[model samples]
Target: MTASALTFDEVRQARVALVGPPNSGKTTLFNTLTGGRQKTANYPGVTVERKSGRLRTPVGRSIELLDLPGSYSLRARSPDEAITRDVVLGRQEWEALPDAMVCVTDATNLGQHLRLFLELRQLGRPLILVLNMMDLAQKRGYQISIEALSRSLGIPVVTTVAMHKNGVQDLLDQIDTLLNQASVTGDGTVTTDAWVEPTPEAIRGYHQEAERLLREAVIEEGVPEQLTRKLDQVLLHPVAGPLILLGILFLMFQAVFSWAEAPMDWIDGGIASLQQWLAAHMQDGLLKSLLVDGIIAGVGGVVIFLPQILILFLFILLLEDFGYMARAAFLMDRLMSAVGLNGRAFIPLLSSFACAIPGIMAARTIAHPLDRLVTILIAPLMTCSARLPVYVLLISAFIPATTVWGGIGLQGLVMFGLYATGIIGALVVAGVLRLTVLRGGRQPLLMELPSYKWPNPANVLLGLLERARIFMRRIGTVILSVLVILWFLSTFPAPPQGATEPDIYYSFAGMIGRGLEPLLAPVGFNWQIAIALVPGLAAREVAVAALGTVYSLSGSEDAVTESLAATLAHDWTLATALALLAWYVFAPQCLATLAAVRRETNSWRWPAFMFIYLMILAYIAAFITYRVALALGGG
Candidate 1:
């Protein structure tokens, strides 16, 4: 079978795709081959990520390499699987059929991983089989015959330790060789009709054939995954596992506060210096005020939290790459099932800790519609990184920095409590929705637990860099744009000159905030808090920025130099601060998250219901918290 006739110089760039099952190290190979040359975006309409990169062969020929989503088969059980199938068959409107397919498999578990390769072979496209994690396989005493496997499968096979970039050149050389053969044969046309979804009987036959091939070409001299199994025995323990998981989380939250303090202080000091320099250099005018009070104070307030956000992501990335995330999900299965959720929901919900937008979109993996919807509705309640700024700010202001028993910081305990509250709230909401609105039979979680390995530093660093890039980009674009508009609203209509109150008291923002204050007053929100909440609808973290700008404008120049946390600590009562913290725990403040829900569900009704319910929850939670705090003498 010849490869697709598409030449390297054809139309734009010839494309090659990496196909594999999950945990096959396909993405690691993609990262190794592409280095920093990759770009990630969604496919034309679907939310499944489209990761493509430029790779130059040893012979100096360039091709676009696509890393398709991992799938066990082309059966299209989920949106990710559907995409893999459609793209492979040239079915997507925006994607053309690839000229060649590279099927990656875990070398240590070929018996299980070869089924997907057999399915891909039926497509008759030019194919290369990659035995990734070859080093690990060899260490485990698995002896694979490269030539025998190639001959049996009728394709070239390459060994790769993708994390270490070993034998990657051989894979590239083979790709060049295949493409050259296709060009000579002049049979580059891809044929999609050769492949079809296998029936149950055909699937069984494929499995049997895969096993036979493995028997002929492979020998196992030692117990497979012995170390992984030994570790799993303890890590997957019923009682000890949950306790360990909680301990890890408690430590993570505590680290978020402890590790981030120095860097956050540096950022705060830098922002204060910049504000002071601007106040000294620029004349007293709208321009100076905009640059100093509006832009610096507002944007800096959010940027200072970057260290904490990245610290949180660092932990998540490391856990995910180390393969512990799967175990955590397994540990939570019982609790999730009791709430009418599949254990699979844990991943999307875990992702919510980064951002609810992606979390909601990730629901496409859940096969059940009701299960997916319930996951989406409760995703916002999972304290995202955006809320970290708000939570940390309030905790720093109101919660004491004193140590408690076992050497834990009280501030971190409060932070952990807030996260725990969000989790409990999500469970309660999921249960209620399941029992009422979207009630349905629950689906059991069926997922693979990948072997544990040391996380690749390159991959973890790449992830952290991408996260930082996205965060800074948001501040430059969305946050910066909103702060400008907010500055205009808070600054204009020039204060009825000679009035005793601050200039902001008579501005457009002030009037609007005042108009809403009466309704929010019961929940402990003043006009400034009301003002902040309006722009906060764009993003939860923006509320911190909004408050900084509002308070900066509402007070003397010295306010711009003082930290927002310190300023809030002085002006806001403990009850109001606690209430605001309670409010954010349930507030559906991100419009992007709503838009994601709308896109995912293909309905306005779900998003609307989501918004209304979250708002009511936020207000009620805030009201109760405020009253309780006041009664406890926090007023």
Candidate 2:
């Protein structure tokens, strides 16, 4: 079992942890090392994500690389930081201590970052210091004496531009060397007294030592942060920043429609061709009905929007990598403070745009209980990607595709409006909650603004690919399952002989929709829409599939051949389409989101309250929209 004598398989079992301060390029390093060989899950009994990957070294030995949550110190303040602390100290339940540590730091901000490195050194583990963003450091004219740094830090040091393919080879070789040595040296025993929470004086001492180390081992050649400051002058301006942010968002929505149109059309055509081939080749029976009406129609309707969803994620990933996300939080702090929320809550809320589940979980980063609760309550209103399918369907069916303001497509304009409505709703709800049940003064937003960098193509592509995989998986699993059940419900208990109405009229789903239609009538929802809403509780996108399935089962042969959008355009009024759109903007329809709220809050009461209030809002919004649109001759 000796380190030097161990085989490659034993080396493969070695676990190394990557730790760093927030925005220190640690994640970029992890991604570069691991590529697609990664798995994400939650640690035992905690909501913080556990990200680990298998990394094969240049020497052909593999090791498990754990990407721990970012932390500034071992004295953890938030749940995320606590996980990092526990894992590093071998206190996390069901998780083995890492064999070695890789402390990644922003090369340009080594003074502040080195403080954490000093603390990790006290743990008495085999540690390597990775100065990531070395390319950026070099551009800014930083001169670091690596030999002196390693001598002073008493550890091996390496520089990396983690976004590049070749940037991490040296770090990998260094890791292999460290693990090889640690195996022979015996387990690096951690001192029990090493991790006592440093007092204010001790903290100041650490800061002083870090500064001294920097002065002796590092030198700056040119004006530091010159480019960052120049860019921030415009991007961080009080007036221009918010305006620019809005313009970027507006453009993103515009691209979601304009850029993805061709791909969406291709997908639509492919689905139509598949349906046609099935109809022409297969014998007409229960199995044909299930395949054509249930699976293809349901899943295909949602799958067509994949291009648009990917476009949306592309914009988000690019902005995030460019470091404007923190600046966005900074810009929104004024308005966030006005609503009695810490600006830090903006990150979680922004994440909600992708999905409310992670958005709610992201709230664990907020320190104040009341603030975090309010954030969790309103996150679902942030217009997640789940709602995109429904929105696109209704908009394409009811709204004219003509251009407005000369070049902007009316559809994209309306899409932007829907996103704006969700944001406004979330802010209003947050304000009300803070004024009432969750009353509390807002905490000041104290966060780092890393220097902006070019978006890494590899990182962006990986993110987009991951999102696409998740969306497709959902279609294959949840949406497919729901569609089959819906098909059975809408097809079973065959219609009476010589029945005049469609066969689904006598089915169970029809009965259920009819039962709920009376209550939904005021909001302009028909029986078909009512049926869709029931399964939509499982996922917002499933509503799209539900509609496709319901319509395919209940419509004529000609209607079944038409796209869901065309069929809806022929049957529904503009008022109903607008009302449904309004409903989705407010409805807490996704059960996964509510479950996330419960888990994050550790109680059912908040989730119950969230559900009630959101349902009320959806109803009222739909009612008002229906009435107003009807008055405007959209009925």
Candidate 3:
């Protein structure tokens, strides 16, 4: 059993890095390389940082997978690009240099993305160029001669439709081969190619080579060109594009409220019925109360939000599939360009509407740290789905469900306003932050605008399923755990026999809230609002769930959804609800996101700082809203 006697060559620890331009399918490739053998970090040094994973080859050799930030070049203008450059070049001694590198380039846009490829070629590392998006390119009549590309680049070239995993086997095979090779793949030419600059001569040479290659191997039907041009006319229209994007975003929030109503109602009804049944069949005791109010109510409250979250994602996925998202990005790039942000940042910021955790994670695509940090700082302002429950609760309870603009629901209008506030606030804040902390001119808006295609059902379904899984996991894990703790807080210190406020009022939570009220007085919040922030740290949505549990523990036996909303309406004033909403717009509530920061930074300092700073901001914002509303003599 000796290593050499086994006849099989022992596997060496191979460090592999995945790098590509934004939207070039680098993530799909990384996921394919190492699926479950990965850990995600919340907050770290740069808002955008590498995610690492592990894989063992069939030969029992180990491989470390580094998912690097997607960047257009190695010029190192931003933290993300600097990281990628440092690790790839072994400039960062703390991080292991990649043994083999995969440069993922969009097959359809190779002419443009090739600039990075050309730059990477001189790095003198074992590298392979992955021609991703091949299927889409093929459909558009692109034909790449692999051998020709390999010869041209002097490195192995593997073509793949990464999303579909097409050609993955070949890519892996080449990677394994490259890993076992003696010299680095592109290292041999480094000494001779002393030029770091892509000089005018170099640019002319590349252009000439590219023209020759296109003439020799590439084929495109005139159809795709004409089709893309026609689509771009409407999609890229100055006035029309932004309007369409806004309408779509507005309709999405509306759908989150309106379309999910039936399912949400069904979930609420089922939870209440179960609770009553449990109370009837079970012996009266702590167990019954715990099941009904603590676990069931807390967990169920978060669960009902799944439909709305998924619906929000569905619209995003469809728009992206229809190829309009890129155009929207282009349109917004006009705005982002003014502030020195990346156009590639649009999708990540959009994702923030679902959750800032993923939104911050998604910023991995931005090449600049400042751009990513600004994006991360402002992402939480996008009115994530977590706040949807709170918004829906308050709006239903307070605002009359009358239509504005003829067809929109009155509740929908309020939700839209919250979203608008987030968006408008983000823009103004981004401008301010860019001026002060991250002052820089807009980065170049160089991004591939993939051509329009029919929405692929399989991909869409897979994406939806993934979102559903993550949604359920959070409810089952983080939300569920927080619910138990909140239930305990609201239930304990069983009321003194003579006390009359409510069981919860005499409970430990009630006392804590009362003690904290003075600090929150200007914010128009009562004891209940103060106490809920405990579990809210687990997630933003849990605040509503905590409210449901705390409110239910007071002996109210109504449905979790409407009952909570109505109770708040009856108990709190308009100013209180408004202040709370404003607080959520910038609340420092997600511990998971903080934890992510800790993991990414490998230190507790950043997450701790984040919590302290955000909490302060939230309090000030909440207080301002409350005092102003009170001063206006309105509740």
Off by over 4 Å in 2: 1-12, 163-167, 192-194, 219-222, 347-370, 384-418, 522-528, 541-578, 595-606, 626-635
Q: Write the per-residue lDDT of candidate 1 for residues 304-393, one digit (tens) a residue.
A: 768987887788889989999889889988989998998878878977886776578668888677888899999999998778778877
A best-first ranking of the candidates according to their TM-score comes to 1, 2, 3
Higher-lDDT candidate of 2 and 3: 2
In candidate 1, where is summed lDDT lowest over 10 consecutive residues?
553-562
Span of ten consecutive residues with least summed lDDT in model 3: 1-10
Clash total of candidate 1? 2
RMSD of each: 3.7, 3.8, 5.4
lDDT of 3 by residue, 1-635 (tens): 23343223335567888878766767666766676566543223554444788976544557788888777777665566777776767766467567778899878777767777777777777889998877777876777788777886688988886656445777777876677673333333333234354667877676676667656656552224467778788768887867877888879877877899899889878877887788889998998878976787667656777788788789888888777777878788867866656777898888877776667666765656578767777777777777776776777887888987889898767776777877887787778778986787566655667767666665466567767876777677766776677778878889887875667777777788788878887788777787776667767766776676567534322455567777777888888888888888778787667765555445687567667756776788788888888888757
lDDT of 2 by residue, 493-561 (tens): 998989876666678877887899999999999988998787787678778766766665334222443
The TM-score obtained by model 1 is 0.89
Instruction: State the TM-score for model 3.
Output: 0.77
Ten residues in sequence with the least summed lDDT for candidate 2: 553-562
TM-score of 2: 0.87
